[model samples]
Target: MLALVLQELQKSKEPLSVAALSKKLNIDQSALEGMLDHWVRKKRLIENNAQGEMPANCAACSGHARSCHCSAQCPFIARMPKTYSIAAGERGTDND
Candidate 1:
């Protein structure tokens, strides 16, 4: 599954939303999120946080991303769901 995820990201011409990846893998969004995190830790993928792109409603975010509750209703959050891509140095490498 990790390999498949890496392959998809490698082949994508642009960043992909978590929802799209979830559908492609036919996996629950939450579960896929966990798996993506694992790949991130392994340095096989890069997670796009979309910083400084916060919505106006994120004023109450408190700057604690992991614990922030505003994400659910934040427009920017909806537009960028922790997008992933192949690591820069590993780009186009078959070893990913």
Candidate 2:
């Protein structure tokens, strides 16, 4: 079942939301999130949220990124839907 998640992500032309993946795999969001977390920990999957940073002057931070507690899940802003992708460097070519 974990492998199936990787397969779906690998074959996708664009990022897929957790909600869409849950429906496609007939699994609940909670279970799907665990699997995604596993892959992310293994450095195979990149959660989109993990790659983003709030600018120091963004309204959410109010020009205080240095002191703001607005880590990835800042409540002042709405988060993007949960999504993951194979890390760029991990998608090795057969020739390599």
Candidate 3:
């Protein structure tokens, strides 16, 4: 299962979401998360915040408001989920 996850990460050009991967790999998202965490510990995978950082000097941006910008009164916050990708120059082993 770990190997399969690694393979999927390797093939994807962009980071993948747990929900998408769960469907693709036929594994539960919770279980897949644990496996992804294992690879993160092994330094074979990296978790990234899909949402980019907010502007530094935005007076109202607390960086934790969960909204895109603090003062814009954005109708919806873009809640980007963490995505997983394989580490550069790392390869998965069949025995993993």
Candidate 4:
């Protein structure tokens, strides 16, 4: 049953609410909540704050990699380079 829940979560791109997951898994809402709480305690899943309620994603931003803007303003931005790395073997030296 736990495996089934984890599988569903893996297949979903967006974080699902407990109610939605319960309906999809055909389990009782309260039971599903208990299972989710267990997973949270195990650190397998995270609980986010959404308007004072627990959500499946973080409160600050959505989890989509392409859509997130936090990286642009991130503190570590200065540490990253603008160019992609090329293999040394793929480039010719000045001796050529």
Candidate 5:
């Protein structure tokens, strides 16, 4: 089930909401939230504020809020590089 959800997220260009994901994948909301929270903690997924519920200054930028200048400078607007998950058995080479 996680694999299917990951695939859907990978195919999407924009951030997906929990409701949309749950409906599309036919999964329970609580279960999906738990999975998403796990990924967020693992740094495999990011949560974006949609309604300004969280203070803008408290937002994460590269895992730290201090790294960004926030409203005063707005220097943290650069796009983040795409992230991906690798299978557990994959071996790393020197080139990597």
Candidate 6:
């Protein structure tokens, strides 16, 4: 199941929110969050907090990288959700 989560992130070109991912994978949101955190600790995934500038690949961004002017508090940007993406340049990870 953990591997599945990684695979989905790898497949996506854009970062995905836990809620959207859990719905796609049919897993409970809380369970999905635990899996995401595990990958983050392993450095296989990067958690995008969405509390500051948004990444270009993030679902919230309108295709603009780093130049986002989002507020520090994400709640103000209702569409911006906490998201995750594959860690850049991570290699040889045993995605068990």
Best by lDDT: 6
Which is better, 2 or 6, measured by lDDT?
Answer: 6
Best by TM-score: 3
Tens-place lDDT per residue, model 4, 7-95, is 67655554567767877899997887777777666666655332222122333433243233564454432321111111223223322
How many Å off is the CA of 89 in candidate 3?
A: 1.7
- What is candidate 6's CA lDDT for residue 27? 98
Candidate 4 — worst ten consecutive residues by lDDT sum?
A: 79-88
CA RMSD per model (angstroms): 7.3, 7.0, 7.8, 15.5, 7.4, 6.8
Q: Which segments of model 6 are wrong by more than 4 Å?
A: 50-79, 91-96
TM-score of 1: 0.62
lDDT of 5 at 7: 75
For candidate 4, what is the TM-score? 0.51
Sort every candidate by lDDT, greatest first: 6, 3, 2, 1, 5, 4
lDDT of 6: 0.74
- For model 2, the superposed segments whose C-alpha errors exceed 4 Å read 51-79, 93-96
Instruction: Tell me the tens digit of each residue's lDDT in model 2 across 1-82.
Output: 9999988888776667789889989999999999989998999887654333554334455334454465567655644565
- Model 1 residue 51 CA deviation (Å) reads 4.1
Clashing pairs in 3: none
Worst 10 residues of 6 by lDDT: 50-59
- TM-score of each candidate? 0.62, 0.63, 0.66, 0.51, 0.52, 0.65
Candidate 6 residue-wise lDDT, 44-91, digit = tens? 998775433555334445444455565454444445467888887753
Deviation (Å) of 53 in candidate 2: 6.1
